[model samples]
Target: MILQPDSKVLIQGITADIASTHGSRMKAYGTNIMAGVNPGSGGQIYHDIPSFDLVEQVVAEIGAIDTTLIFVPAYQALDAALEAIAAGIRQIVIISPGMPPLDMVHLLRKAEATETIIVGPNSPGIIIPGKLLLGTHPSEFYTPGSVGIVSRSSTLTYEIALELTKSGIGQSIGVSIGGDTIAGSSFLQWLQMLDEDENTSAIVLVGEPGGNSEEAAARYIAEAIDKPVIAYIAGRKAPAGRHWGHTGTLAMVVGRGEDVGTAQSKLAAFKSAKVPLAERPAQIPELVKKALK
Candidate 1:
């Protein structure tokens, strides 16, 4: 998404208990201290931003939230998401993970019931530098430009964006789709939007070791779009059965030393679609530069 100046965001579950990434919190708020939510934190504040106990209370005091980044614990994630939807949050991004499948089912049901857009149950959320940031991803590494980034791993999002910045390629928008299977949105959804975005001249997709999302994305890239694309898949040699993080992190777990190489296989598929694949971090800049050409 191309970030504008008027994007308003609300941060939920901002407390001293799970509050570790104050740096991310600062980067996201930027100059617009819209609002913050924490039940017991009514009088407490972060970065000079006001805090509230409930979503409805915050909405009543500060008006409706345009978007929200949920930082509550896994147990409260579902409730937090539902509250945001009920509070009339147009866009919701859940940064917390470990949410149960049943909770996700409930959240998706609630979101669909209200037509609210959910970004993640286990994600870094979405960010547009100098505009709005939802979730915990750092904004210092990003600058607004032409390429749009969407990834399954928050860490990968930062790593890839840093490489792009070093190559002097900025992004129109960057999103972490979260690692949960029943999470929020998908790569295809973001792809369709970016394809229509005039600001986005190209796209960068970062995929992980498991699931058919990469395959699905590759298929879409092959038939419909003509814009330049670059990609890199992690877990080239991941242990067969080891569940890393994310619900979709593993497809089939076999045995020890029998790591089913996925990153290279996925990259091979992208290569068949004629998308540039970067083997190393340093290669990303060069590859993206060439692809955008």
Candidate 2:
């Protein structure tokens, strides 16, 4: 299941420098953050929340954790994520700004076998307007409505959401699969799930010049989805030989750089699928309204 309001939540690096700020905000936003886990800081309460050394401790005492937000640094992300999965946490969101690509490879392989869902190695996180907050997403920019949002760029995610809200179009859910070239969830995964979501009437997919994720999503949207879908591809003028957000891109890029399709190609893919394309953020709401028609 996607992160829910009632999910027993834990912060793996809750005592870290950045954790307390976002932790407090997430709690204030009404996420059921049940516990905090900082290996050496266990038994010491932080942010007025109980702290534990291990995920199992949270499970044994506070009950099973449904989701975890990891704030550990890039080096520790793999260990922290592995521990959460080992403790039966199904949904893991890595809010770390960077993680070794090889580390992500190992973590993703483990996640696949365990059926764990990883959100980002450098993601802003997920938000359901007027309901739940999971990462660093700006909640004030979002309003509750029927459009479901999925994006690969952090800046564009907020920009697109604010455009919808400004146009009086509220969102059912907004997700940043992160800026990484390789992420846990894909456009196809979120597109499929949002298509099934009862509250979502349409979807806004934000893409950039990267791997063929957009192309794959276009195929799925054309063949499988009955819901109205809108596409917005970023980096229209980016040099075709390069891609943005290189944290994870550099890893897979070596073996499959050619697979990183250009923004022009992505725009073409969505157009070919006959999906409405938004050339700019401001253009999305009108396109969204058209799709929902």
Candidate 3:
């Protein structure tokens, strides 16, 4: 399958077990939720959809071709993640949290080995307004527009869209790239798509403290791109050696005299290259408008 932006999706792991915890939000967002997988829960119903015991059964019965949101437990998350990939599922969105770093590394390697594209082991998944919504985001937060959004923070992505909406601007595509230290895709990959998209007038990137992915993206922007980019890095004051929330929010220094891992300094580099920085989240709308003008 081509995995067009509007393809059908199946959501696994959405049973009474996890539905009470996470599945409810996904259903509320208008996902097909074709079937939930919870061992003996097959034949059970959730949000009016039949539950299945395994992904193979769901795929065979429902023919959901494009995407999946893996909400299984951390211990079994890797197996579930690999299963979806092995089944030739194109876009798998992982919403489960607390995945071990080694597991994520292994999953990424497997994904590379299989040529599969995974979204998050700790992500909000992807949402293309009015077409397909396979993630945990509230539908009301987004509207259709020309700017494509890709961020490491789901709540912050919502906040940015909310700010954009208040100014009568909306998004073309909004993707939460997950805050994990090991993620399937990068902001640059998303940016390349957004840059080539005729519907996308500009791009907004949201970054956090952990890795230099944002910094590398900034350098890419400095080198190329006729499109304007507005960036904001969160968790500036995050203490060293204490990566509390997001996996990649802590900076790593290779050796002495190396400047790294601070959101403020990382974001400051953008200003040097004329990339506008939002002093605060509230300023994002204005910064985007200014960038376009």
Candidate 4:
């Protein structure tokens, strides 16, 4: 589900301020933004892009759509996603944050059944350096290269990407899976994709404390991934038992003596898997260079 420069994109809820602003930026970046969807705002023009009442309407009038960038309010995000799925959009990126967890569960189920790929419900989206920008990532921090990045924290993703770019280490693709507890995609899923991506020489996995996602990815990398994987787990100094912004960044009890979801636990998982761990965002480029060697 890597968004290519040629991928036709539709902006759901494009009439909204956030969506419209980013839509214009994406268009200026030379993205093939075909249309925007805004129920009653249909037949109107937003930032020079056509608006539609529904994704189906867009498809019927303009033809097939390859991907959808969702910017609807949190409450309407699920509906927009379902509508895109129903309209046969295979790839969708939900940028709105704080969506209800249960709704995401339902959306994930439907997406899985339909073989659709949903990037985030609270994400910064995906960017392929100068090629494509699907979400709200700051493109100036990125440059075309061979390092692929998958992060849970959007801010940290940008920070590390900037470090990489400044250090002359560009990226092949960078995607923020969102910091939510349950995302439509997983670290392992993206890792597998990067493993298969010939353009990606190595992968940088930016994980946050509080969630077995990093642990799970560690186990998978040890067994399945062949590419060199550099990892950095955020919230290293975060207090235990405290809930972070993302649902997945909350500590939980799983077994005796196991501080599941803690930063130490995730770090230990990476250590056990023999994956190099970056002490800080700035240290990531060095680790990436080491891995490439």
Candidate 5:
């Protein structure tokens, strides 16, 4: 169900400068972006991709779309996603980062009812190294290989992947589960998928200090995963009595409440689970190599 070279993609806000900029990059990367939905701009062409006023029109003209990468404004994300969902688009990747959590709540309900797969409100999306591209992941630093990467932080994902790439390791697939606290998908879900994937020989989990996601994944790895895993928690806890700052973009989604999450807590969870814990990005490949031994 992951994005592939042939997956038909629809862009919801293809006309926006942000969308067009990234959309062109995605297209250049070989994504089969079938058409775009730009409301009144139907029957026109923009960036050489066919444009439509509605999701249904695109479907009728170009046929069933397998995935939709939405570039619409945060406030309008709900409507764009719901429209795509109602029209039978099963996979939705929201590129908007500041989407209201309440809107995500409403979107998730419908997604569940329709058996849809919602990737993120703040996701950098997913990729299979050199083969497929979706959302905003920078694919240049990646090369196709046997490792699988799943993370909650987009910037951290890129950094880790770059490190892996530099060490001559390649990834089978990599995904940003979501940057928000209430993500559409979860650490456990992507972990299970990676575990089942035949292409994946090992996994890299890029976690942060927020939520129980790392703890949950740690438990799953201890009990279920057949492959080796290396984890790196990306940030530190704020100073006592201080509020979360920009250094806590990953922490912003999950609160800094005591007993909830911390770098030590998540790192300890992986240690207890018997997964290799890499304290630095440069150490991941070495740890992964040792684990695979």
Candidate 6:
């Protein structure tokens, strides 16, 4: 299930200094962060939330957990995620960054076997406007409305959301699916969810140079989604064969000389899909208005 306002959440590695910091902000946003998990830190209270040493313990304490926000160190992220899965926590958002790709491969395999939905290993998590805050997204930049935002960059997601708020275009949800090469979710997945969300009237896809995700999304939108989609592909001037901030944004070769992750290639995909493209963040509002028309 998609993250909702009432979804019961657990924070893995909550005793860590960084987790405590974000946990405070999450509470202020009214999130139902029911419990925190930190091995050996169980029974200790942090930010007024009870802490547990294991996911199973937390589950035994509090009923069923719907989602988990992982804040453990990169090295510990794999175990934290596996623990959540073993405890029947199907939906997880990994907030820790720099997790080794090999670790993600293992976690992703298990998640797939169990039908778990993971948001990020390095993601900012999901925010449902005024309803809930699951990760570290700054809440003030968002407003409740009819638009949906899905981005690969956390910071860009905030910037665009703020721009939308200032332009009177509020969002139904803003999701940062992480910047890693292997994310738990994809743009198409989030786009499909937004298309079915009654509160979402349109969509904004913020992509960067590198991966073929934008191209894949463009293809899916053309064939599946009926909603108007405004597209923005960053790193238009970025050089080829370099990682652009996100691990997933690194240019790579797949086969016989196909440049799938270039900005020009992704922009072309959007063009072919009949989706309107945004040259700059400031140009998005007008494009949204145009699409609605």
All-Cα superposition RMSD per candidate: 3.2, 1.8, 2.6, 1.5, 2.4, 1.4
Instruction: Please provide, for model 5 over 133-183, each residue's C-alpha lDDT reduced to its tens digit, 9 standing for 90 to 100.
Output: 887888888989999999888888988888989999999988987776568
The lowest-lDDT stretch of 10 consecutive residues in candidate 5 is 240-249
Tens digits of per-residue lDDT for model 2, 96-177: 8768778889988999999999998788889998889998888999999999999987878999999999999999998988
Tens digit of per-residue lDDT, candidate 3, span 1-293: 12344466666676745553455555555555566666778888776667777778878887755777787786778888877776677677888777787998998888788777778767887766665566776668888888778898889888888889888888888888787777778877888878888888988888887667877888888887779999888876777544537664435534322346567657777876678888678898888888889
Candidates' lDDT values, in order? 0.74, 0.86, 0.74, 0.90, 0.84, 0.88
Give the alpha carbon lDDT tens digit for every residue of 1-293 in model 4.
84779889999999998888899989988899999999899889988998988899999988999999999998999999999999989999989888898999899899989999989878999999989999899998999999999999899899999999999999999999987777879998999999999999999999887668899999999999999999998888888777665755433634434378888999999999999999989998998998899
Deviation from native of the Cα of residue 219 in model 1, angstroms: 0.8
Candidate 6 — number of clashing residue pairs? Answer: 0
Q: TM-score, each model?
A: 0.88, 0.95, 0.89, 0.97, 0.93, 0.96
Ranking of candidates on TM-score, top first? 4, 6, 2, 5, 3, 1
Which residue window of length 10 is worst by lDDT in model 1? 252-261
Q: After superposition, how far is residue 200 of candidate 5 from its true place, in Å?
A: 0.7
lDDT per residue as tens, model 1, 1-293: 32445666677876644442552465445624477788887877676667788889978887866777788888889888888887888688788887787888888888788887788778887777656665566778988788889888888899888888877888888898888766677888888888888888888888887666787788899988677778878776666555555655444543322233256557778988888887765677787777766
Error of 5 at 64 (Å): 0.7
Model 3 stretches astray by more than 4 angstroms: 1-6, 16-30, 239-244, 248-258
For residue 11, what is the lDDT in candidate 1? 79
- Model 2 has a clash total of 0
The Cα RMSD of model 1 versus the native structure comes to 3.2
- Candidate 3 — which pairs collide? 210-248, 210-249, 210-250
Clashes of each: 0, 0, 3, 1, 0, 0
Comparing 2 with 6 on TM-score, the higher-scoring candidate is 6
As a whole number from 0 to 100, the lDDT of residue 77 in candidate 4 is 94
lDDT of model number 1: 0.74
